[model samples]
Target chain A: MIDQTALASAAALLGESWTPWLVVPPGLLLGLIFGAIPGLSVPIAMAVFLPVTVHLDFLSAVLFLTSIFTGGGFGAAIPAVLMNVPGSSSAVATTFDGHPMARQGRHSEALGLALAASCAGSALGYVILLLVVGWVADAVLLLGPLEMFAIAAWGLTLIAVLHEGSFIKALLAGLLGVMIGMIGMSARGDMRGTFDSLALVDGIPVVPALIGLFAASEMFRLMRRDYIVEDKELRRPAFSRILAGVGMALRHPLVVARGGLIGIGVGAIPGVGAAVANLLSYAETKRRAKDPSVFGKGEPRGVIASESANSSSEGGSIATLLALGIPGGSATAVMLGAFAMHNVTGGPRFISENLDLVYAIILGNFVQVVVLAVLGLGFLFFAASLVRVPLRYLIPGVLLLALLGCFSITGDMMGPITMVVFAGLGYWLREHGFPVAAVVIGLLLGPAAESELLRSMQVSGGDPAFLLQRPVATAVLLLLVASLFYPLLRRRRRA
Target chain B: MQGQRGSEVALLLLIAGFAIWLAQDAARRSFSFENLVLMVPVAGLILLLCGILAVAALRRAPQEAGGGLARVLGLLALLGGLVAGLETIGFDAAAFLFLLAATALLGERRPLVLLAYAGIMTFVIIMTLGFMLPYEMPTLLLDPPR
Candidate 1:
């Protein structure tokens, strides 16, 4: 795999890259814009731009799409930090500490940390890919339905139990979210809880629900404040502050490395990518932290853990896409379409024949990481100005953008309606001390857990002993049990 | 303590009721391995958990700080009306009106600033999203029906 011939071919490809350099800037910008926006995700941008890629050569097209992928990964975290609105679902965990850091007048540091970690993670992910793509994909395939259920269960439990509120209430909120996720028609085509609404047939759209729960609800809570940050002196966007943040992120090398490794492991598994990786990494980082209480209250490590994991997951997803010819999620699925457009297939055969192309793509991602850091810094200089906008303007403007974004998503009233409804519900839930993060995660992961459990039961003829078959599932189950009980035990010991 | 706890209990009861309703709906289907398979089991579990949580919540005092209840309610009402008015008044008109109402509701008292902000926001939205993006939102003023 590390042959001189392959290395020379990669170098040649890099040297002969005609307009690939030209496409990189626009590709990253397109990704950043789409990712920063509320509803327009990386997949949507890639899907829309995929057709244009047909006119370009294969290498340039893949390079352009992946640049968007890399840019969007970090771009999603901006709104998550500043507004508690995850521009994409992958950034949901980023909001846990990122928003608190913003509220504490540390928004620049948070954004900088996220950017630095993202660049580092992307570079590391591709390095791992350049070494052992085959091993990563094989490991990912071992994660069956049982293992998925355990992972989802672990995430929900951790999110609920780790909150500063009443544990039971958090659990209730999480359970309610899962129930809401099961609202549409089930896998068997039987309607579960549509309540006679035709829109319920297709299930509640996650993006609108997320915008409602996080952004609109936060906007409502923010109506009392004049500005997001109360101290007038700390509101301006400063390049020095961002550099300080970058320095702080560079100081914590271990956290970034751990997050990146977790991302690669979880992201390679199909149907579970950055969405789960960020949350899992954050939870794990907090669990191992010296002072876990600082996690949701502006801890820089939280942002580092989340951003690195989500960013690194891109490499793992691409590994699965190339080596196994399996797309890990929607973004990679769009890349698969790009593959089709170029009349190329990705599998073992492609790997055997075109080892140089694989190396070129990975090498391009490494360059993307460097380009993203420079470009992302410039973008943040402008984005940080958002904190300076008064609440009165910010509230309505963000809400309007969210409403229109939702409309763009559903192409009907359903999107806006779901958003407004969830906004009110989310506000009430937040007032009652329910962990909205738990609810959102539950909503996001519920469908996967449900389907996995159903599939497990189907495979085992509805026997509870079916869980005993998978060793990985058993180990995860044990870990889940420990996670649930360990916190209560510690509380009791403190008392 | 009692007042906050009462509200918490009520919320939990509502959730429990919803869970029960969901379970009942799931039960309406046959117990085939394929149809409504996980729905009944999951709904039942949710109902049980909601009941347990409701009992637990009833015994606790809420410690959350929520001072802006009225503001939250007001904004929600405004957004509700904005959604309802979108198709009739169109995206541009409805958005401009909603911004004006929202800014005022959120304590922006100056008329000129409000007008300027609303106009600029509406223009930017129409130009960027309405014209630039491929989204085909229903609009009366900007994108009239053929």
Candidate 2:
């Protein structure tokens, strides 16, 4: 599978140019800034910077863009650790343990673990892509609607795994999120709960709704506290502590490896990317642990699982974009635009013809990972200072930023309006001991689940027997069933 | 404890009620297979969960203390006001006023600190966001010279 000639050419091409290396730092910085903000995302940063790539060679352009992808993957975890605000949907699971750690005055360690896990995951993803880029298209082609629905069902099992207080309440919250996610128009041109509003036609915006549910609601809860870290002695950011955290992540090689594999697999699918990948990885990691109760309460392994999967998902997404000419998600979609700018099309033909370029792209990401580690340390050092700010000022300040960010998302009042409404719901849910994270997972997976199920139904003409024809889908569904009952079986055995 | 329990019950009912309303609306539209494939089953599950939760709430007494209701409500109102003010006064002025009010409500009594923090922070945020986003944000005081 390895192309020796192409590999040599790729090395020569990279070594020939000092220009591509220079763009890496600025691109990474741009992604970090965009990804660290609550409303903005990696795709947004790439979209904003796409025009600039026109001034450079194709190799330089892609390197710059991929560097942004690398940086943004880790950057999104920053706010999730410090403020219980996932900067993007992909970082939601990171907050499950990350924010709790922050509250416990271990914010620096959480940030460090996220950073190290992210770099390792990105490297692992690219290494896999480097080996399998030639065959990824054929593999991706086998996933039909039935299989996709099965995968989504597996993702939804996260709700059960994330249960904390009341299992009934968690189910209620998750189901409610599913209902909310289905509020817009159906696939068959039928409007369900639009309430005659034009904005509701597309559905509730996910980013703002999540920001409201997690960040704004958490801010309301933090009103009684003076600072994020209650202990004055633990509020300061220490470089040594961050290094310890990095060493800590390295100790758990199996968790990082499993998360990376899951990320790459899920991210390769179209319409599903890091958002589902992180949750599924976290669920699987928690499920397999000897004592699953340690999760979601400042567990470093939870942070590692979430961060690794989400970061590796970028490479998984890039695999689809490169091998099939299909944009895996919005970020890869923007990258397709960059490809067009340079008159380069992505597909089997592109891969076969420009194997050298493909190798160069994958190899460049490996280097980007190293640069990311160096830059991420500096970034974490500065971001870790957020715990020092008093909640009195930090609360309002972050809220204003979120409000403005939401406003920028929709260019109207709708974004902020949705955020405020969900903020109320989130606050009540949190106050009443419901798992807000379960609701978030439900919201993220609901539409995908519904649409995929509808597609499966249409394909099978409502016949349940069609499931037997697709062994993969049947196996996945069975796995989902097993996962659902495993916890109960484990508890029963322990008792 | 009673208040907490009451709030919990109300939330469950609210969710159950919303699910019913959505299902009814969908059925009213056409009850097509595509429209109800996911909704009907999900709505059924939500109602069942709501019943279970209401029972659970009644069985167990609330143990968590509640003292920050007023501050939380005040913050919520301030946020609501900021959203409302965004359209009337534009982002720049409205955001500035929100920071001022929010800090005051949160117990920042020093006038100079509040003014400086709100002014500088809002200006920096608005300016930074304005430069980064492509959309034309509505701003009263900070509108760029076009």
Candidate 3:
């Protein structure tokens, strides 16, 4: 079964100097730097570096990028724990408890738990991705418009659980986001909120808006505060305490499974990336917690749920990229440019025809996890230095960057100004006990869900019953309904 | 504070008006099955829903503590200033001032450090946008030229 040509090509790809293990440190450190900076995006990193892949072969470049991606996921925890600033969207959950834990003088233990969970979840996600690629391809393709609609609805339900305040308020926030999304045109060729001005045509760029809202708002909040992060000497969690996480991973297989599945599912969808995966995983993990009291309170499982899903989705994301030649998210979209640069052909047929070369890429994830684990543990031992960085230098520079980034992105003032408004809106919503997570979920899902729904409707000639006609779509719709009422149902049972 | 809530409600009303106007415009276009107007009513209804809910939320919790009116008002003022200043202050001037003002309002320890970073960031963004990846704009606003 070992084909000669495939193995030879695989060897040629991995045959570079330093092989797989050599580029690990540089890849990881660079990722840490990106994550350390609050507003720098992963897609930006991948896109900028894609040209470099032209000189190297596909396997080498992929290995480097994968290492960077994994490292970026781990590195985001640095700021999340330090300044309560999330360096990446995936690290939002980490900041919830990780910062609190740092304040409590338990940085080492918290970080150790984060690292171990990140590695375990990452490995689990990768394993699932590698084994289930073909099966997932078949399964995802079977999902019709109705099922996709249900999935979006389910994604929206995360607002209620994650916000943990009022379901009605969460629904309000999600609906507001959807309404905002309606500002742009639709798949059916209708202009919305255009106001006769060409400038308002495209509605809003989610990435820029997101960057402005979350990243800039954070800076604004920091500027408004006169606060100090008191330095604390923390206990170094022993190898046993950290390794004890493996059993937790094994014991709460559902958490690991849910995170991995969400990661893969989110990864398979174009444009939606690890950010959604992390949010979905966090919501699912919180919703499923038996005690239901541990999230946002330094629970080890919370870290595992988020980090695992973030890292796990990387492998699945790559499969989608390779098979469909469609970029799964921001980062991989950039990787596609790299693939084109290096003249590497990608698709489902690309793998079977060259199985060894494909396996080399898959096996490279194993290397990424190993590197992530070593670096993560090493950093955890001395996490105090990371926590010691002063916000004074970072705060102002970051604020400047936020505005500058916004203006520069649109090359106009409208974009930067939008950042201020969105940030204010975000702050306002937060004050009102509305979950920021719900709004983000709604904003991310709105256009995609609406367009897909519209397309499906048009395809079925405007038949509303078309949703229930398909079995997969029906099941997903039912699941969406369940996600909404499950808590109320449980409350009734208790009563 | 009472004034603050009133202004927000007014904005909601304005937005609802805009939504109604947009829906009317959409309805005038092709009403065929292919050019569906279904989402228009749906979207308008959602806006009205937002208007109702936002007014309700504002009413329900009149003075939920923390974050003063100055900060809130200053944020609104910043948005207005940025919109007014763009295209005339020529991005660098506007951006530098925007960061300077927003950062100052936010509570940074030293303005000098932030201003320096703002200057550098302004220069880079301008150089990149103007030189590296330039874009064309047809008068960001329709007002008479200076």
Largest TM-score belongs to which candidate? 2
lDDT of 3: 0.64
Looking at chain B only, the TM-scores across the models are 0.80, 0.91, 0.58
Worst 10 residues of 3 chain A by lDDT: A227-236
Query: Which regions of candidate 1 fall more than 4 Å away from where they truly are?
Result: A1-4, A196-198, A462-469, A478-495, B1-6, B32-67, B132-135, B143-146
Query: What is the Å distance of residue A22 in model 3 from its true position?
Result: 3.7
All candidates: TM-score: 0.93, 0.97, 0.81
Write one digit per residue (lDDT tens) for candidate 3, span A1-495: 345676576566666556555666777666655655555545545554556667666677777777777777777776666556666666766666666666665566566656766776777766666566545556656766666666676776676777665666677567566656656666776776667566667776554566555655554455443432453334334455445544454566667667777776776765566777877788777776665666777676676677677777777778787766777776787777777777777776776666786766766777678877877666555544544544444554565455554554565655666676777776666655665556666777766678777778767888877766788878767776776677677767778
| lDDT agreement with native, every candidate | 0.84, 0.90, 0.64
- Residue B40, model 3, lDDT: 65
lDDT for each residue of candidate 2 in B8-52, tens digit (9 for 90 to 100): 888988999999999999889877777898899999999988888
The TM-score-based order of candidates, best leading, equals 2, 1, 3
lDDT per residue for candidate 3 within B2-42, as digits (tens), equals 55455455545654665566556656654554434344654
- Pick by DockQ: which candidate is best? 2
Show model 2 residue runs off by greater than 4 Å.
A487-495, B59-65
DockQ score, prediction 1: 0.59
Assess candidate 1 and give its TM-score to the true structure.
Answer: 0.93
Q: What is the TM-score of chain A in candidate 2?
A: 0.98
